[model samples]
Target: MSGVAKVVAFMQRSWWRAALVFAVLAVAFVVFGRYAVPPSTALTSGALALELVGTRSGAVAVLRAFEQQHSVHAAWVSITWDFAFIASYVAVLVLALRYFARPGEPDLIDRTAAKSAVLAGAADCLENLGMLAMLAASPQQPPDWLGFAAFATTVASLVKWVLAAFAAGHALWLAWRKLAQR
Candidate 1:
């Protein structure tokens, strides 16, 4: 098999593994996410964002819970969480960009891939900015409950969904493209 053929075969074969990993990760997050998050003085962004947000439970709760469990200060946890969040956001963004980036030598496939990558990269940036804004608003000032709600819904949830949608769209597009090529 050609390199591209091999890559495609690998992806097809491992698709179930990918889905399983995602499922397991989701379960793990549901179990441990509440503990991993630090107390929030502000709103959440990035992965914390949701499409259907409830004003009742949110990032602040998770953050507080994590801090209490770990017996650490919110201040310290915030710093560590901030870095980890940023790193995760950056890593996703880079991967998203590469999804469309390798347009093969001026060919249409290359161009299409490049466009997907660029869009994914842009999504990553927007996601990062949203996350960064949340991080910025979180420190020192005690967060207004209304502000947290808004941040959680608008900045956090909206951004998270947008990124997910983009990723899903790219995946479908790539699959179709590959199949069409075959």
Candidate 2:
């Protein structure tokens, strides 16, 4: 079979595995957030981080605060865990799109949804890298590269969400039409 066909077959057969993996990763994220990062911080959105830090000095201050909270190790661990989360999230989301289109070939809505899910995961990985860079340099002023990282993170994040929204809307519309045709 073609690679695409193989992937579709795998997704069709193993969506539940993806779901289980996603659930474990989700729980890990929540636990890590509670102990190390705030839920808002976990998102790793550059705009949101800048809003929290306010300025270079603010970044130092916040890092100090995080240190004082004795959550630094947990925070670092969470950063590493993010990779697993990203993989699992993408798998689950993409598999869900495939599952939704099962018993037939995927139409445009399913194809779009799968593509959007993959894009969102890629964007999220970029955002996580940006956050890790900042976190690694915490308690010190961020480098000039932070600006670029932040810009990339913000733009990618926006694109990811918008595409996901379009996918969701399409899914809903498609579902409605299917029901109406019955």
Clashes per candidate, residues 3 or more apart or on different chains:
11, 0
lDDT of 1 by residue, 1-182 (tens): 65433433443466574455445545554444343364453323323432122332454444444444443244344434444443343333333333323344335644454344345444444544443443334323436663454354455445545555655465556647755775
Supply the TM-score for candidate 1: 0.36
Least well predicted 10-residue stretch by lDDT in candidate 2: 42-51
Look at candidate 2 and tell me the lDDT of residue 75. 58
lDDT for 26 (candidate 2): 74
With candidate 1 superimposed using the best TM-score fit, by how many Å does residue 79's alpha carbon deviate from the native?
A: 8.2
Best by lDDT: 2
Whose TM-score is greatest here?
2
